[model samples]
Target: MRKIQLGTTDTMITDYCLGTMTWGNQTPEADAHRQMDMALAAGINIVDTAEMYPVNPVRAETVGNTETILGNWNRANPARRGDYILATKITGKNAAFVRMGEDITAASFTAALDASLARLGTEYIDIYQMHWPNRGSYHFRQNWGYDPSAQVKSVTLAHMEEILDAADRMIKAGKMRYFALSNDTVWGVAQWMRLSEERGLPRVISLQNEYSLLCRLYDTDFAELAVNEQLTLLAYSPLAAGLLTGKYQNGAIPEGSRMAGNGDLGGRKSPRVFDAVAAYLDLAQKHGIDPVHMALAFTVQRPFPVSTIFGATTSAQLTRILDGLDVTLSGDILDEIDAIHRAHPLPY
Candidate 1:
């Protein structure tokens, strides 16, 4: 695994980050620990999770179980905590189970970080992120009816200032290292940056948005913002939540899969999604490459991507994803992927 500088920070994280979204849900605690061990042994230094993780079902009862699982691992292996860079998110809106559907205000941010650190059994988290904007986002199958006009500018600026003040306090208290954003747009990121610069608060080191071969929204405006602002993209859903793995091809939802856990797979279950997946899978086969490898390699090959976060419910899936760390796509394969994108863009 190749390591890259994480934004302007001193930390160097692996290009492929181990994602723990399935830690306490589709994957068992033991399996999560085993996967962590394997990822560390394989030289992956970044582990990404969320306070509302283990989220295939995303029930109130199982909320924060993923961090708890990682906490247990950290407690049992205290010396290993410093070996890997850990990143987790505070839930945004839509998660009624978290903070009773409160937006990420100063109090909510402080409360969330305190609880997260306690659950992880850590003194300081490496990277803390806002799960999404307080306003809505177009990600997660919400692009059709998404509207940001309802948000008040003054209210949003006050909210940003509050969060940045809270982040400064957390940094002083040694509870978190840095703040980042997820599922954010270009304007949202600019506000975060501006707030940090104006208030002398912790600047956002990364932005974790949905990016994949099927979704190239980041290649446009966000790519430019990332490059100029020195904001690295910690790309989530690099495989489109396993849609690009070719396992769900032809409407075949294997038992015990993510799609089986959540039929919609977080709103990625469109009829056109299958066609897009088939095109990428065919492109990989045409080049004599594993689809999983090709899909992940393409993500890592993006210009402004810092780390590609990938998760697995089983170790076999993890191994397959890890094998693609060195698989670089050829110019011919890139052209084929471009051709497919041109034909069927934005399938989901």
Candidate 2:
């Protein structure tokens, strides 16, 4: 229930953000509403969604359904809209269904935001993010063969300039309060920061990258950048897609689980991931703390500003995660976690 500053912006967001990627697909609208009510009651103010949500099977037909559900709730309870900090993203290239697979340009950015506003039934989005870079990212299982060389330097800079211009225009138009990045690399964040400074456009307020106990990609360069650049880390998949929760241990995927919907969990499933999860689970049990609490708490305890984005298909799951908010780990427990990390550095 604690609130943290969102970058240099005047907005203060809850330490835990409610993620809505599963709202319309793995979770129904009624369940989404119930979860929203529960999350609001718990003092969770940030609710993050994307233009292309209801993910798991991310279909063209189901695109924007999650925002629609949120929009419905906003319309029904107009007074409640001001109670939450809402964020959404504009899809990047490679999604064939969005903008017919065109890379995000100034025009495409405007189009995406207009449509997103319509879907969310909001006059202005609190935080508008670039879902991913047009040059692609190292996240989402692409780190194995990911290469940034495919994009020309001039092209990338031009894209950044154009996007920043669009973001500035949106800010002036009252369509968005601030802009952020998602699934970005350290260099990408630097480019955004540099471009914003040069053009006097909206600065990059946050970077929503994947970070969890099993996935520590942000611990290296990104951590330093986050601190120095004053960019808050809106860490998505903070539970490593539920791996850190220890529910998928020993090849046990419960029915209707995310793994069941997408067999590989968007590239999270690997031979060594289980070992990493087991180590964290063992550390939690040794300290007599729930693994979910340890995992969520670990993220907020990082050196930089972090708001862990967590989602659940059921209210019970939400309650369990919310209960872990106040559970802080001790120094000895952190030392043990570090020892485990030393033994198995990069399990996935």
Best by lDDT: 2
Weakest 10 consecutive residues of candidate 2 by summed lDDT: 141-150
Whole-model lDDT per candidate: 0.89, 0.90
Clashing residue pairs in candidate 2 are none
Stretch of 10 with least lDDT, candidate 1: 299-308
lDDT of 2: 0.90
lDDT of 1 by residue, 209-256 (tens): 988988888999999988888888998888887899888887789998
Clashes of 1: 0
User: For every model shown, what is its TM-score relative to the native structure?
Assistant: 0.98, 0.98
**How many times do residue backbones clash in model 2?**
0
C-alpha lDDT (0 to 100) for residue 131 of candidate 2 = 95
Candidate 2 residue-wise lDDT, 1-348, digit = tens: 788899988899998999999999988999899898989998999999999998989999999999999998888888899999999999998999887989999999999999999999889999999999989988887888888777798889988999999999999999999999999989889988998998888899998998887789899899899888889999998888888888799889999998988888888888988887888888888888989899999889888999999999888899899898888888888888889888887677
